[model samples]
Target: MTVKEGMGEEPERYRVEFASGTAASVAKRRSFRDLERNDIERDLPGWPAQPPFKVRGFFGKLGVHVLSATTGLLMLPLYILAEALGSPASPEKRGELEERENEIDDFPVMWAGEGETARTLPWQLDPSRRSWRTVTEIELAEQDGLVRIWSYEDTGRGSRHLSWGGGEKVPGSEAVLWSMPRSEITSAEIKRFSMAESDFTVSFRDGSWARLTSSPHGARRIVALLGQGVPEGCHPA
Candidate 1:
């Protein structure tokens, strides 16, 4: 009994196929594409508007502005101090300190570097104020072809001086090897006094420097770089 007049074709039948005898059934077909697009507009309610600004009186706004300005002003000094401390030394400061230093042709001067400044011992005194007149002299001696001496004092103004060649060994004076300021002094290498003499150089604050040698010539060159007498040449590099 086969009937095919009104029906198009018998509904298609499917059979499961498994490799390991595992049972399988037809899976339900589901899709959420349309629902996902419409969910927010259809199901979610609209939120009301929020206040434009904080709920406060006019005085409150003024107070907030004033407080902010005051806080910023208070921090300014602290920031400046931190910067000054952290920074090494500026050319201006180095120049000022160099101007304060003095150089002489007879003695070796020693100074300490202090944050773009140099410090000397036995500070100078006013010459005009002194009732008694005094003269200070420095001496240097050649020992084993190398300059060496003991630092001594003399009767004079507390002025500092750099010295080098002299004839006699004075009692009140000592021999010193003029050295560069520790701050500007980049490197100190021990080399043959004559072989690598050009390796030595003395720097100044104003970006100026002088080539030096291991002999007394180096000492003289450093004194010149320091600008012991030229007030304007004391600037730092």
Candidate 2:
């Protein structure tokens, strides 16, 4: 592969290695111009399509930011008031945040919500404190011989608008936050349920498990897709 240089800049070189243990789709560059194209590299046929993050290119993003900044300034006092008046994260939760910040900080980590139904919050909340009210993207990809689930912060910095838009762009800087290899994952199925959301467990080969909470519809769907994948850890103490 060759990189182009024209603006008195030195050419940079790089290499990407794929582990044969996993499935991958490879497309060779037809021309040096191929480098200019910014498209998703891995194209999984059966996987879900990416969510939309529309704003256009640089100017479009700039305009949105300017508008948001203007609006945000007006809303600043309300934001400050909300911070003062609204309930804050409990000391324990704050401690947990700091403790796990190193482990996971790009995307919001799981947590209970406010009020009586605290423990029953969605597996991923609408406006998460961890994500600073920004939407975090959950994605599945085949890598390192396993199909893995990944979360990208603020949807890969896709759409920065305040509300009503989302999607991830795998900005290279995006970190793989939460995921376990498919080989290690025994199953991901709902273990408990309520009217609003269902709590599911992701069992592993070692009989260890992680719990996930999702909407009722989403819960069954997730299990249907991943529950039967070499299921084994039925009893994880």
* TM-score, model 1 to reference: 0.17
Candidate 1 lDDT score at position 143: 21
TM-score for each candidate, following the candidate numbering: 0.17, 0.34
Model 2 ranges off by over 4 Å: 1-129, 134-138, 142-145, 155-173, 228-237
How well is each residue in 35-119 modelled by candidate 2, as lDDT tens digits? 1222221232222343321223566546655765686678777767767988432211111122121112111112111211112
Q: Please name the candidate that would achieve the greatest lDDT relative to the true structure.
A: 2
Each model's backbone clash number: 10, 0
Candidate 2 has a TM-score of 0.34
Model 1 per-residue lDDT tens digits across residues 65-108:
57656966786777677778995432111011111111111111
* For model 1, the run of ten residues with the poorest summed lDDT: 15-24
Model 2 deviation from the true structure expressed as Cα RMSD, one decimal place: 21.7
Give the distance in Å from residue 103's predicted Cα in candidate 1 to where it truly belongs: 15
